[model samples]
Target chain A: MTDAPKAAPATNSRAGTKKELSEHFKTYKHVWVFIECEYGVIHPVSLELLGEARKLADKRGVSLAGVILGSDANLIAAAATVCFEHGADLVYTVTDPTLAHYRNEAFTKGMTDVVNTYKPEILLLGATTLGRDLAGSVATTLLTGLTADSTALAIDDEGSLAATRPTFGGSLLCTIMTLNYRPQMATVRPRVFGMPPREPGRRGEIIAHPLNLAEDDIVTKVLQFVADRDSNQSQLAYADIVVAGGLGLRSAENFELVKALASVLGAEYGGSRPLVQKGWITADRQIGQTGKTIRPKLYIAAGISGAIQHRVGVEGADTIVAINTDPNAQIFEFAHLGIVADAIKLLPALTEAFRKRLSVNRLAS
Target chain B: MHIVVCLKQVPDSAQIRVHPVTNTIMRQGVPTIINPYDLFALEEAMRLRDLIGGEVTVLTMGPPMAEDSLRKALTFGADRAVLLTDRFFAGSDTLATSFALASALTKIGQEFGVPSIVFTGKQTIDGDTAQVGPGIAKRLGLNQLTYVARIVELDRDANKIIVERRAEGGVQVLETRLPVLITMLEGVNEIRRGSLESAYRAASAKIVTWNAAAAGITDLTKCGLKGSPTIVKKVFAPTPRAEKAHQVPTDGLAPEALADAVIAEIFSRQPSVESDLVRFSAGQ
Candidate 1:
């Protein structure tokens, strides 16, 4: 259905100058990370952000803080302490019963209120479902720029938060700057940052912010929290080693072969986007940009000709072993090890070999 | 039950590549498709309109050529198509883009009946930000449901909607009022092709075109690059790994032998991984 075409818009029109950078925004200071928790347990991405923000905070010579929103005061106080242990210099929080389950309306209003009262130069959030839902609404409410799914966050030359993310469908990377906005906001994907070592007995300042939202104000309600049927809980996010397959496995039956290898090697099993689309695996088992990002010590990919979307997810792997029939597969370009063979055959053989080797080692020991 | 679906035309990411030396996106040969994600949304919207007595209007903000995507939507049973394109809308980021689209939606309501629901793809592949749908919902004061796996129920008479929304590890069955913005996750349903008769009607359909002023936008500064707060300072391909994939020779080995050789090679290269694997996989 391609028809008449128009010239593509020229990509250059950045509003020139420090003149547009208003004086009122100068009052904004420090970097803030939204410490998201569900059912009392702090999401690991929140801890990951503390480390990333710590670096940016040090670069700009500013204090780093975590904003914890929860339903109970005591539970939130404990979460705030963990933030201190994970590199945050201070904690800003609000504890209200309504804050328990993530409702976009209440959380957005609460976060927006805090940002307006105590502006920060940079505000970070995990790119989780809760964080994304809140960040978009909050950023819109604050009338600021928000860079989403950022792979990297840094302090620019002008002391602005420079958020780097894969753009154009991960074909390339672009650094975004919210030049004139207060609370330059960004949502970093999980596993993009390492968990900074906790300093036991670390102390930090705690500031409790008041949340104005009440139950009656929110339009949406959490009818119930439905835990997934398959409660393996998508450990791919934190798995030390992952074995992933793609459509190259040929069928869901063949997918079990990938899982067999992972089992023998004592690693987690995952697949590319297509396998998830084919219903061979649940969405949580999908690994790529749109799925869980992983930084395992070892990643074995079979039959997956890496798309940029999947490439971004696995690039952090300490070692990547690619198996595909196509020698020119994009996975081969970056994989530490490559094999030109059918994953259907190679996976099963690999599983048997690993089983024998591991068993022999166990017997000898 | 008037529904509006937001559509975007993006380059086929599968065909897109990067320049090795220059590290620039080579979009020269890639064909533009109606962002594949949006098709899922279009199908859902059309299905609702078919089930209920209503109209399905498709809208998008891109170059003049984006009208082709709208026309294609019509072929899939959309009743009307609106294209919002203007030079004043160029260089807009997600924030500015949402502002323009929301303004256009308001005008569409004033012109053609108020829409009860606004549907959009979870995210555009080109942007991959997944921010615009929520931004628009916020601007227009619509209840936003994102990454929806299924529409469990839509009660036009009761002015309510229930959907299965994908959360971190679970699906949230959320209920909301009408006039909500729903961003459909991919693969909820297969897109249907048009019948020949429908294709004929789509070819002859009159597409509505709106410029910034025509779209009822009040401020000029908030229309384009001036409105956008985020600026891209650098766009480059990621640096390649220094050590490329080391190929394992598979010339003269049986399947078992090949596997054994590969395992031995892996151990020799990463002796620590062998110990690490042993410790974890040994039921520890």
Candidate 2:
């Protein structure tokens, strides 16, 4: 196999001979969202997309549909019901025994089958592990386009999907339009969109689809799934408050002081991208454009310079408190409260004060 | 077995300075550097090739200047380097970029031995999309694994690779067959320096530059903006918040007193937050 001389590109995998759009592609209507469900619980990002899809649906004057794929019929039904509660007008679901765990081949086949049968003009998915894997495969199978990690989505005057998101490492925002592609696909991060209110009694039509896949046909297997629910695993997305450290902290050992403040405040602790790259913290604890996006009520930063990459994740906080020695650090520009002091010195003082005050309040109550 | 690593050349984003007055990028003397994340991928590919008997070829889709990055990969112990470039491929989004790269890889596979494994960075620092790796895998129909923390086992005889894939909340142990694509996570392993002999070879090696047509791109429309569906309508900066930071009066104050002052300031602003904190801490 190694002896062949390298030459021209080999042709395979949905390489279209023609360049123009199909008239059928123009007929594609409605907003469809892929409902990402794992272990009987639907991923929250899917519900968030339904909320966003609802707005796009309203703008386009079309129905909103949620597409769910799984092995268990009952689980798929439950997901469809939840999708309805989250403002889906209808649901197209595919159920099969081979679809239990997220295998790319099965999910792509199921999604492509549903999409080809009932076309959608706009499609959204969560930028989760499963969603990214499935979206890329489905988009390739369909020979369409997909924009990843969009921060904003809207229907423009020409009836195209306008997806806006931070680009070039979050230094600037760019609005992208998938004008020529049918089923304009994009993935949104978890916290970028709102969680739609669930109408408890709301119901929608559930159209069942079939996935004729067998176990032997799948190439990959999920050997085992171990929950990484360790105490240190980050919970920044749902935290009430977050304490983050950045390159300004200087040393890996100094990052612990950030943790001390988080503990005293009962908040989640995280670090910027450089801290993670320096092996000071796990990637899971990294907060930035490339990492987790947080919307905590209060985000306390100690020694962070607040680069635009890090700013994108923490800007959603209600009150940003930045503590840095540099008076003119970028963080102070956006921080609701700024403290010009050494984080090493100020963290201990803040930790002690918070621990004492909170304990006192606890005892009094 | 053969391995192909995809890399990119990005501006050294760390050194870019904003002018104090105009807030415009200070591009003077800002050097082009290979994206840091791709180094991890290159290193992982080299390590795998070293462990088993195979060759590692580096690939990139960029302008002619990007040939420098491909040569750098050769200096880092790649067996060969290929640069896929064309004027028609300019301003291509992830979709067009992946299409061009995938065509080049198919060409690479036909020229060399079919690659058993393909590797890429988790995402480029500039694009930050992380879509190309999966896109290539899907187009090639390889078992795609993104955000791989570690390569646990590679049984060549069995033609299987097991990896620890990083997900949203946990690490998933996946066992997949050969001809798989992996997007290496950062900081997992440090990149190694090129040997003296390899560095010398890299200095003299002629990089194979291919245009879109030579790469067997059949559709010209899909080669650039025509193939790309995502059109950039506008670029803008986020508006700064109306209100600025309200610094607590801590000038000349002791540490303990400063903490107290900040606490008082916060409590005065939000009474509900204090009560919620107390209730949460007490687990009520």
Best by lDDT: 1
Candidate 2: global Cα-lDDT? 0.81
The regions of model 1 sitting more than 4 angstroms off are A1-11, A15-20, A247-256, A274-282, A325-329, A362-365, B279-281
Residue-level lDDT tens digits of model 2 in B1-284: 79999998877766765555543445678777788989999999999888987999999988798888888889889999999989888767677778888889999999987899999998777777777888899888789888888999999999999998876566778899999999998888988888999999999999988998888887888776566666566555667778778887678988889888877777777666688789877873
By DockQ, the best candidate is 1
**DockQ by candidate, in order:** 0.50, 0.39
TM-score of each: 0.94, 0.93
Say what the interface RMSD of candidate 1 is: 4.8
- Every prediction's TM-score for the first chain? 0.92, 0.91
Q: Write the per-residue lDDT of candidate 1 for residues B1-284, one digit (tens) a residue.
A: 78999999888766777778776666686788898889999999989888987899999999898888888899988999999999998878788888999999999999998999999998877787788889999999999999888998888778888888988778888888888999998878989998887789999999999999999997978867677777776666677778789999999778888888778777787788999867655654
**Model 2 bad stretches (over 4 Å):** A1-22, A231-234, B17-28
The local distance difference test score of model 1 is 0.84
